[model samples]
Target: MGPAISLLPALAIAFSASQSSAQTPAPYSPAKSGFDFPIYTNHPPGNTLPNDPVRRGATTPPLHPDETRKLIQVPPGFEVRVFASEPMVVNPVAMTWDERGRLWVLELYEYPRGAKPGEKPRDRIKILEDTDADGVADKVTVFADGFNLATGLALGNGGVYLGAAPNLYFLQDTNAPAGSGAGALQKANKQTVLLTGFGLEDRHELLNGFAWGPDGWLYMTHGVFTRSKVRDAHDPDGFGVQMDAALARFHPRTKKFEVFADGTSNPWGVDWNERGDAFVSACVIQHLFHMAPGGQYNRQGGTWANPFGYVGDLPTKGLPAVVDWRHYRAAHAGICIYQGDQFPPEWRGLVMLGNIHQNALNCDRLTPLGSTYRAEKESTLLGPAGEALRAKTGATIKQGEEWRHVGPGNFLVSGDPWFRPVSVQTGPDGALWVMDWCDRYPC
Candidate 1:
């Protein structure tokens, strides 16, 4: 519940420069030979004319679930199966399980390829269920729709919270009857846009990554190139905060939003350990931050010197990452602290992270290092049938079809390019469930 007193007058707000609709970046030109892909292009600096071709055809069909399952490599004694895929569920960007064991999936049909400036929103949040106790989802219900590039999802406070960039919406279905379907949810659901003014320049980097903290506040992430000036919906002209590449905390009942940490570069995944200590996985940087209140981490576009005059020294600026990732661009996505009893006892408290670009799942052990923490990165997912794509992992390769890159240092890298893991979580049954944003590339 919200505080009795008005907390608005004491808070400070930062309003960044506003961009007109004309300033929006142009959509991908599918007409060009090299531009037919659905994902965005991140051209390496100084290589403007390079010709990197797409492996799949311009109109490549989605992979069937049976064929897709063979391409993935799970740990020994662990079996990976297709819980759901396209035609049944498409473009699953994010997912969270409700208390009743229902999986809520966020579908972003308009990603990398976004809706035109004036185009209406075309996204939906579907509730998936497995009624017969089968491993796969057998039912789907569209709980809400008509959202502009909705990228984040979390369940708390009697509703589903959605991050649609420039707007955060809460959809509550108070009057829905038992076993409600899409139509019933649509009729009973009430849509409330709680806050607005998030960055939208880059489609991937908006107000995303929603997770409820142990402290009862909702934690969210903003990526680099974002310019957010979020204000209270109740008081439109009142105070807000200018947030860029930072962790934001919003109290649902209080309607209070504040910056949890000051600096970060496109944080994509966040979760907590058994001890309630926060850990985060950042994109491109390939590092993990152990977050604390008021702590600052790496900021992409800012310049500051440390005590030793080291400019842009991230370790000095804030808490250093538990693991630096050492320049391997894994394109980290959703992360989770293994809390289920289904996995081996050794994996009980480890942090599991998904690297979408590298097609691998990684685990790390956080060991206390005085006041801060340090991590010992464990094994990575190995490519199937003993063929690892990266040479650095050759030594850790094994002989079986399920051979994972066993590591004191090696990673598990699935040789399959279609294995794009966007979110990794401990499923209701205790097996780790991975959401494959299965596409030619991530947008």
Candidate 2:
């Protein structure tokens, strides 16, 4: 057992934002003719793209699990024990270890670096049971199936929320009684389709990443799948024409979703500091093009819409929203808010994030500077087994990258751009748990 602390006390104390209400949106005009398959400003499709290390090393060498042994990298001194290994289903997108200490892993259909199109789904909502209290998982069972690739999942408040393909779904995890066999996880109940209608263009930019922020409101991001179906155009607060909204915070009581932020590409993770402000993973837009440089999609700048800057305060119509979030190329996945009593006050409110494709995990300690509080990367905790990867890799990284297709305009040329996700959670044992493709944990 661990020390007890309030999860959303900040929402009640110091939480003063405008009131939000939910209403059924009326119909809107049809989409423009050119709206069939989306094309970025400049994408040169077809021809071959420059080769990337991972792409060229399509015959990549052996990836050792012990790559992070170098670099005095250690997180908060919390004793970490691998709760499970070879987590089975590709990259373990997100994980939630409930109050009862039950662990849930949302498996992404495709994994490793740069996920492509053909390998879209490999299925199963892997639920693990450690019944014996021995760190390792004693039982593994399918919690749910038939998913187009689930990216995030968490157990909070009273239910379990999953980052399903098109939207977020809430399932009642009344895992069977203690004596009940592994069969308990197999059956999923109290299924509620929390939100719907995320444009399922290719894979990458679907609306995903849901978690209860420190403020207590349900938060979700409306990834970058341009506007397939706009809910409300008459609504004055709408961003503009030709784009699906970006992010939003939902009020269960009111049953309405208010746009939290806009003008960004697909964002991977959403986490808030102890004070309740937000931070986005800001995933780039070109991953889908999956090609080399000089192609149409490969523009002069690197993934412009959301580069190195994590725009914050995502807001919708007067509500406090994501003001900004930093940008990282293919920064797909992993983020969480840690407020454990075990760590010193200095470490209490930090936001931790994981990157699947980048093969790294990072953290941004929240600090209050003068008038406002901002996030700064405290450490790049675990990076890809660089030296080892290089030692084993066949070729030296190629210099310049070129591509065949010139794209519809400028931004959609090379890479296939599939989505990558990293789910973060604070376990019952008072330790932070992160699951990527190869490893995860904290005791």
Candidate 3:
């Protein structure tokens, strides 16, 4: 009588969320006079947070039905399902592929709702196309149309680098449709805001995540905007999330944005690990994907959590993001790392994530997802759309397998909270792709 903690399946728990509170609650919350303000860092610049960037703000893959991310365990080999759920094709937070394997995704139409913080978005920044890998997406165009809260997407140095929140753009494929084009996305167009005044949600700052670090440089993270309610100055909530949340490294040759690692509160997902070194994830759709390997980090060092009377020291903090704090809260979006081998290679470098709170998607190994950041591995069950909901629920566990487990990181664990596949990419074709901003709906 002591083995059944196995819950989740109450319809993937809260699934679609009733619809309309502007799509089921939480968005619109900006203007605390723009959340309060007090940022700007890099430390020695006279140590700052006195606010700057205006203060702010703000994925793909697809699959739904038959559950997702339930405390994962990946060891059996791999089969995971769903792969498609386009909730009308909009909120696709961040994804990239090009070079011909296709898969684009940036579509994040007006996503931050209620509870008041700095709300100001109407929509624009769509772009999707699956071209048959089946994770869903046959078309959902409009690559850039008045964006203000786009949040992460990269190809690197050569082009296609976006993150738009306070605006960061570059698209010249001019009208990329008819199969997502190539030759550098057939020369895209529009979208040109390289770096404007980021709104910084409330000192959670803004932008969230962005990556391109194979040494070519680009790494980023910004979130802590409640104007200046002061949430993360170094775990401002610690495992509770938000620690002054800010880490940067985008010297596209001195285009400058330095500020290498700060307190960071809303440090959402950013990646780099084939050795070029660099990994971050604190989007908090639930939390535990907080790795920090820009090389054992050190803005001067700081990590003594409980001394009460250190009088003045605090820089012993080198690689501390193992926050695996229990059952994620929607963990809003991602947690990618795995280097790839199509699975079962000892699961390779290991780390594949997307637990939009549940519906499932995780597969750890990055030293045990940073050492028991929960999901030591597995939570597959995502794909073939379960033969379109098993013809309508006759559910005999239909079809065969290839990567299936479906839910268990305590049900779509995100580290702590948030929902929907916020973003996931460990691609080069070794396989590990998720971005389901709505995969087309019904997850």
Name the runs in model 3 displaced over 4 angstroms.
Answer: 1-93, 96-104, 107-124, 130-140, 152-206, 210-243, 246-311, 317-335, 339-344, 349-365, 368-443
- lDDT order, best first, reads 1, 3, 2
Q: Which lDDT tens digits does candidate 3 get at residues 80-145?
A: 333333343434556666676555556544444312346554344444455655443455555555
TM-score for every candidate vs. truth? Answer: 0.79, 0.58, 0.28
TM-score of 3: 0.28
Q: Using lDDT, give the best candidate's number.
A: 1
lDDT at residue 276 of model 2 (Cα atoms):
53
Q: Which structure is stronger by lDDT: 1 or 2?
A: 1
Q: In candidate 1, residue 173 scores what lDDT? A: 88
lDDT of 2: 0.43
Show where candidate 1 strays beyond 4 Å. 1-39, 42-62, 177-188, 303-316, 379-412
The TM-score leader among the candidates is: 1
Candidate 1 per-residue lDDT over residues 1-443, each given as its tens digit: 11010000000000001111223324322111112334335667654533432222123444345443444444444545445544556667777777677777787767655666786767788887768764456687888887777899987766778898778888888786655542334322688888888778877787777888899999988786777888876678966787887778899898899988766677886788888888877776646788888776666655322223234555355556777654234467777787887665766777767666555666677788887788876543322333442343444443442324434332344555655666767665576666666555544
lDDT of 2 by residue, 261-375 (tens): 5544565567665555566655553221111111112221223233333333332211121223442334545466677655456556666555444333445555564544555
lDDT of each: 0.62, 0.43, 0.43
